[model samples]
Each structure stands twice: as structure tokens, then as C-alpha cells.
Target: MARILSIVFNPSVDISCDAESVQHTMKVRTHNLKQYPGGGGTNVARVVAELGGHAELLYLSGGAVGSMFEKLLAAGSLAGHRFPIADETRISLAVREEQTRREYRFVPEGPVVTTAELQPALDFIADYGADYIVASGSLPRNAPADTYARIAAIASRTGARYILDTSRQALKSAVEKGGIFLLKPNVGELESIEGTKLDEEGATRAALAIVRRGAAEHVVVTFGREGALLAGSGGVLRVPARHVETVSAVGAGDSFVGAMTWSLAEGHSIEEAFRFGVAAGAAAAMTPGSELCRRADVFALYEAGSRTIN
Candidate 1:
């Protein structure tokens, strides 16, 4: 099996629960508490592991909360490469309302990372001979916006496929620098990157425009409810979104990238991988707060999609 190295600059401990109703000046009793190791790369690695793939996590860890994060990762038996720092990792919370089924999420900006602390992860990637290198999530505070671009250069030198999922300047800088094998950007992100408005009809053209510019070999433009469009040298392929009762939207994007990358690494066609990604994302959305897609749900959704396409 191919090994995947997932990098997360700022990882966290995800805490989730359910409350009867949320009111401004009242104490809302909660139940069904669950905690998971989180952050983009951590979530991606977890999904890969759930799908029976070998994934190695590379993330920054420190502080008491960071120690708890390490314990959570160990509980899942995930192989991790920890980068030491002085600041404690952040914690994110999600509270689901039983009455309205609405989820409220509180996310904190993670620790500020200095160049010295950030350099080791880049150095690790330069030497790591993994089949795929996935850098997911937001850049830590004070980290260079060109962080992903630097990672792209290393991937180019080492001959590993680079998969990027991020937004804003971090994403823009990377795409501008080029050498990304696969880029998963949502519709709004594509609009931001291309600096234009994109409707469904214009989505494929916009994605292809990114490919033609040599920014990325393949671009997947994901529409929250409208599914995704995959554009590459082979042209554009559309994968419709699977209709499922919404539970939580958190981690769906990461699940999509993780499943798609794992499927592609397992020798599936790009189209097939896209379908798997769609299914995995739907599966993630079907779960309650903070929890990712279950393996059984992912396979079940994938099989259902196969039937629909066939």
C-alpha cells in the first residue's frame, strides 16, 4: 500500500456535543460528548485510516492540550510525526441543537509559528519518500503565506504527488507557484483564485483555466450542495452530489480530499476517485458534530453511487 504523509501546521482537539436548545442567557445542558483529533491534515489522515489505508500524520504539537491531542491520536493508533513547539494547540467546539438540528461551531486561531519551528516539517517532507504529500488546513498565525508553495517545491524535487486543500493567500500563493498535482477548491475559493464570478456553467471553464495556466494539473471545484467538477488535461468531469439528510458539514471537504487521494493512490481512475470523494463527503455530512465519515458509511455510499452511474 502506498503511504501518505499528511501535514497540518496547527492541529487541535475537537470537542462536540448535543444540546436541547441554545438560548442567549440560559445554561444549555449537553450530552453525547465526543472528542477527536482534528485540523485538516489530521482529519484527512483519519479518513484514510478509516478506509484501510496507511497514513502518517505530520503536525505541530505542544502544551497540555497538545498532549491530549497526542493521546487521542494514539488511541486511534495513527502513526504521527510530531513537531515540538512552545505554544499549546488550539481546541475547537461544535454544539448541535436537538430541536432545530443546527450546529454551532467555535474555532480559535491556532498558535503562532516561527520560522525555526516551521522549518523542520519542511525538512521532513524533503526527505520523506511517500507516494503522496497532503498539506491541508489553515496556516498558523505568523507563518508565511507561501508555506504551501515551499512544500510544493519540495514535492516537485522528490517526485511525490502534492495534494493541497486550503483557501485565501495560502492557497493563492501555492497555485501561483505551480507544481500542484491535485487542488481541491470550493466554488467560492475558485472565484477568489480566478478573481471572477462563477456559475455552474462557468465552473468547468474556470477550473480548466486554472489547469491551462499550469497552476495545477487537476482542479476539483466543489459546490456544497451542487456536487463537484473535476477539470484536468483529460477535460472536465462532473460528479453529482449525493442527497442525504444533513447532520454536520464539518470535515466533509477533508473527507473528500482524503478519499479521493486514497482511491487514486489505489489505482482507480480519476473519475472513479471523484465519485468516491463525493460519497465520502456525503458520508461525512451525515454524521453528527465533529465525527468524520465512518468506513461502513463511505463504502455503502460508494456502492450506491456505482449503481447510480451504471
Candidate 2:
């Protein structure tokens, strides 16, 4: 089994519920309230576990909510390492509109972190020996923008392949620093990093540009419903999307990253893993609320695309 370490700098307790319609200044009644230990890295770890893979999650925890978060992780039986902090972990909300099937997500900028707290987290990651180190999600407020870049440096030093999925300057700083094994960026994020708009062709070129510049070994650019582009030294492989009845869009990106990493760790080719990723992303959309891709749904979609995936 591949030893995977997922680091969550800005963790959350995800709360999701459904309402008939969303209106301003009106008391809305929601049904089926669901809560989960959430954050980019935690979601990735959960997806890996759902896919029958083992991943150890490392996240910052504090306050009452942080204790609840720990219990939630325990409920799922996921292997989690909690690092202490003074601030409370934030909460993210996802509201599903039943009439239109739209999801409204409200994410808070996470708590501030002191340099003292930040350094220990970095040291823990640097010393840990894992086959793959995945750093996802946003950096907390007051945390340095180059935090992911520092983690990338640790990944290089430890000889672990690093997979980065974030946005804005955090993404740009890491890419500019180089040494990423794989970079997963959405269309808007790619545009932000390159400082320009990109069509499908433009996005492909930009992804290839990152690889050409030696910023990363592989670049996976997701184009929402259109599909995704996987570019690297070998070439670009376009993985088409599977049209499905989307219940909610939450967690789709994390599902894609987690499934792809799991597939690669299982010894599948990048092309094959990319196919699995697309399948997992589509599967995630088929479910409601913040719940990620179900294992059966992922397998079904993967097998459905097997004929054309290769």
C-alpha cells in the first residue's frame, strides 16, 4: 500500500442541509442536516478511504468545534493526526436548493496562525517519510503565502512526490518555486495564475507551459462539465466528462484529486488514473450535499469509461 499523507492547513467542520428555495431575510426550514470533517486534505483522505485506500490525515485542531471534528473523524474511523492550535477551526456551509438543484456554499477565511504554530506543523511534515504528500485547501489568515512553497521544499527534501491543489497567490508561489509532482488547477485558477483568460486551447497551452517551465511534472486542468486536460512531458490526454444528474457540486474537485492519487499509488498509468479521476469527479456530482463520491458509483463510472479511457 502507498503511504499517503494529507495535510490540511485550514480545516473545517462541513455542515450541509437542503431547503425548498433560498430567499433573503426569510426563515428557511432545512431538512436532513449532515455534518462531516471537511477541508481539502480531509476530503481527499476520505475519498481515498472510500476507494479502499489508506491515507493518514494531518490537520490543525482547537476549540470546541475542533473536538467535534476529531470525534467526526473517529466516527469515520479515519487515521488522523491532530496538531494543537489556539484558534478554533472554521465551519463551512453548503445549502442545496431543491427546486433548482443548486448548491450555495459559504466558506469563511480560516483562523489566524502564529509563526510558532506554523513552524511545528512544517517541521512535522518535513520529518515524516511518506510516499506521497498532498497539501490541499487554503492557507489560514496571517499564514505566509509561501506556506505551500515551504511544504513543496519539504517534499523535495524527503523524496516524496507532492501534489498541490489550491488557488491564487498560494498556488502561484508554489508553482514559481518549482518541484511539484502534479498540479491540479481549475480553469479559473489557471487563469488567475497565468493572469489571463483561457479557452480550452488556451488552458491546454497554459498547462503545458507549467510543465515546460519545470514548475511541475504533470498539470491537470479541470474544465467543469467540458472535461479535463492532463499535460506532461509525454503529452496531453483529454478526459471527457460523464454527463450525470448532478445533485451538488461540492467536493467534486477533491474527489477527483483523491481518486487520481489513489489510482497512481495502485500502480496505474497517469492516463488511466486521469480517467479514474474524471469518473470520481462525475460520481461526486451525482450525490447530494457535501457528501463525496460513493465507492460503487466511482467503480460504475470508471468501468463505463474503460472502453474509451485508454
Candidate 3:
């Protein structure tokens, strides 16, 4: 199994409820109500684990919610935790309304982690022999925007590749510091980084700019149902995203990045890895919740998706 370390700040207990649709604010019935350990890095770690890879999740956590977070991860077969001394982890909820085709999300700002607490999580990745460090998600208000950049820099020093996925100022900060091996950002995220609107052509151009600027060796743009584009040699390769009756959009991007990382770690080409990523993302959308997509689902989707793209 490959060693993959994921560092997440602002971890949370994700609760999702699906109603018929978001027509009226009336008592929207929930078909499913479940809580899981989630956040970009955590989701990536979980996906990696399901794909038969060794995953070690590192995050800032403390208090009762932190304890619960630990307990939740412990129930699984993953590796160690780098627990910090904080109060309780916050809760993030998603309300899916199929009628109106809307997903109403209520997310807390999450707990503020001290710099004192940040080191252990960073060191955990370094000491754990991580082959790839996935430092994703946002930091709390108290932390600097360059937080993930700092961690990625550390990983580079230790000879570990860094794959980053986030948004806004933090995303910019992460890549500038180097050590970013791959980047998976949606159209919106890409546009934000490029400081422009990301239509189809714009999205491809933006991804290329990131590669030109040397943000990462590979930059992937996911366009939801439209598909994805990879900025690679000669030119950017376009891979059609698999169409699915989307149940939940959350964790879809994480699944894509995780599968791409898995393929890259296995020494696949950029185009091959990007196709696998597209299938994985579609597989995630087919599932209901955050920890939904399984390795088997990804494999099946990949077979069909390969044909769809070719």
C-alpha cells in the first residue's frame, strides 16, 4: 500500500439530509440522516483508504467533538491521528432538495487552531513516511491564509509530493510556495485563481496558466457534468465527465483528486490518470453522502467512462 498523508484544518462532522426537493421551506423530509468525518483532506483520506491504499489522516482536533472525530476514524482501518488541543470540532450540514434541484448547506467556520497545535499535524506527515501530502480545505480565521502553503513547503523539504485543492487567497498561497505535485480545482476555483470567469475555454486556459506559472506539474479542471480538462504536454487533453443522476455534490471533487493521486502513484500517464479521476468523481455523485464512493464503483465507472471519452 502507498503512504498518503492528508492534512485538514477546520475538520467537521458532516450531516446530510435529502428531501423530495427544495420547493418550499416546509418540513422537508429527510430520507437519510447520518454523520461522518469530513473536510477535503479527510474525504480524500477516506477515499484513498477505500481504494486499497494506506491512508494516514492528520488534522487539528480537540474537545468532545475532536474525541468523537478520533473515535470515528478509529472505527476504520486507517493509520494514526495528529490530535491538537482545541475545544470541539464544528458541524457542517447539507440539505438536499431534489424538487428544486438545490442543496442548502449550513457550514460553521470551524474551530481556530493555535500555531502551537499546528506543528504536530505538520510533523506527523513528515515522520509518517508520506509519499504524497494532500493539504486541502480552509483554515480557521485565526490561522494565516498561507497555512497550507507552509505545510506543502515542509513536505517538499522531506521529498514528498504535495497535491492541493482549496480556494480563494489560500489556494494562491499554497502553490506559490512550491512542492505542489498536482492540483484539482473546479471551474469556479479555477476562475477565482485566474481572476476571470471560467467558461469552457477559459477554464482550460486558466489551468494552463497554473502549469505555466509552475504552481503544479499537473493542473486539472473539473467541470461537473460537462467533464474535465488537463493541462499537459503539447496541449490540454479534454476528458468527458460521466453523467450521473447526482444525489449529492459534496465530496465529488475530493473523490476525483484522490483517484487521480492513486493513479499517479501507480505511475499512470497524465491522461490516463485524468480519465480515472473523471470516473471517480462521477462515481461519488452517484452515491448519497460524503463517504459514498467505493473502489469498485470507481473501477466500474472508469470502464464505462473510458469508452465514453474515447
**Steric clashes per prediction:** 0, 0, 4
Give the alpha carbon lDDT tens digit for every residue of 1-310 in model 2: 7899998989999999999999999998899899999999999999999999999999988889889899999999999988888998999998888898778999999888888888888888988788899988998888889999998889999999999999988999999998999999999999999899999999999999999999999999998778898999998999788888977768899999999889888988888889989999999988888999999999999999987566
Show the colliding residue pairs in model 2: none
Largest TM-score belongs to which candidate? 2
State every prediction's TM-score relative to the real structure. Answer: 0.97, 0.98, 0.91
By summed lDDT, which 10 consecutive residues of candidate 1 come out lowest? 301-310
Between candidates 1 and 3, which one is better according to TM-score? 1
Per-residue lDDT tens digits of candidate 3, residues 1-310? 5567787787887888788876566766687787888878888788877877766777778788887777777876656575676567888888877777678888898887787777666666667777778877877667788887887777778888888889888887786675577888888887777777867887877778777877788888888888888885457888777878887767889898888777777777778888888888988988875655778889998998777666
Model 1 / residue 17 / CA error / Å: 0.8
Can you write out model 1's per-residue Cα lDDT over 215-247, one digit (the tens) per residue? 899999999877888999999888788889878
Query: Which candidate would rank higher by TM-score, 1 or 2?
Result: 2
Superposed model 3: Cα runs more than 4 Å off: 19-31, 98-101
Go through the candidates in order and give the C-alpha RMSD of each one to the true structure. Answer: 1.2, 1.0, 2.3
The C-alpha stretches of model 2 lying farther than 4 A from their native spots are none
lDDT of each: 0.91, 0.91, 0.78
